[model samples]
Target: MDALSLLANPTLRDIGAGAILVLVVLMIITGRLIPKATHDREMKTAITRGDEWKQTAEETVKVNAEVLSQNSQLIKANEVVEAFLRSAGPSPADTSPVGGP
Candidate 1:
């Protein structure tokens, strides 16, 4: 019964309203304290998977940076070698990969 009925018939509905009120108050209090998404098993799993993806993305960026740096160094070294070769003109014994006269 509602609070008004329970109040009018205190002998019959003595603890009914009080019990419902306590339950509602408890729910309100706990809802504020508890995290909604973490309570869900699927949501917790999704959060963990999101963290894994973030870590993977960070690792990918780090590896890509290292590869880019190595490529830059290789390009610089190749330029230096080509400049030396052009200055030296064709060598009789030069069997380099670039192949020259």
Candidate 2:
């Protein structure tokens, strides 16, 4: 008999049809629904990990920016000192005769 006819007759003689229906339901739950739930859980965990990495990257960028600013200031200060020394020329103490001493 067809499935519609089997549902119409709910007697002991139709036990086989009922058992088949129960097995199909169990298979659908195990093969499709359970795996989907597990996949969704894994995706959530991965997204959380990605967010943490993004935060760390942002902090690293801020630190790098501060270091770059400090380096630029040091370079400017070094340039100023070099320019001053070039303009000052040699001191009088260094004017002694080279061959005598």
Candidate 3:
């Protein structure tokens, strides 16, 4: 028979409807299960990566602290140099003229 006539048959229509229903149910089940599986997998990966990131962040902070400590020491030394220069007054270089050509 023609396509429309075949679809018009009650037996064929019922079978098609049942197949669609089964497909819908399977889709619903997979829709629920796949994302949960994906989410769980992603969470596990994220947790592992998070630990690695945490360690990297901690190492970065430690390095930054060391750098800050060094910077502070440098600042203190600069302050000492500035104080010494101020106490020493103008150097002879300040009054000296450049050599004439």
The lDDT values for all models are: 0.83, 0.86, 0.86
The order by descending TM-score is 3, 2, 1
Across 2-96, the per-residue lDDT of candidate 3 in tens digits comes to 99998899887767667988888898887753567788998999999999999999999999999999999999999999999988876666765
Better of 1 and 2 by TM-score: 2
Reference-based TM-score of each model? 0.51, 0.52, 0.53
Which stretches of candidate 3 lie above 4 Å from their native place? 1-31, 35-40, 91-101
What is the C-alpha lDDT profile of model 2 across 1-101, one tens digit per residue? 99888778868556787787887789878774356778899899999999999999999999999999999999999999998997795666687776656
TM-score of the candidate numbered 1?
0.51
Q: Evaluate candidate 2 by giving its C-alpha RMSD to the native, one decimal.
A: 9.0
Give candidate 2 regions above 4 Å deviation: 1-34, 89-101
Which clashing pairs does model 3 show?
none
lDDT tens readout by residue for model 1, 53-86: 9999999999999999999999999999999998
Candidate with best TM-score: 3
lDDT score for candidate 1 against the true structure:
0.83
Residue 4 of candidate 2: its Cα lDDT? 83
Pick by lDDT: 1 or 3, better one: 3
Query: What local lDDT does model 2 show for residue 70?
Result: 100
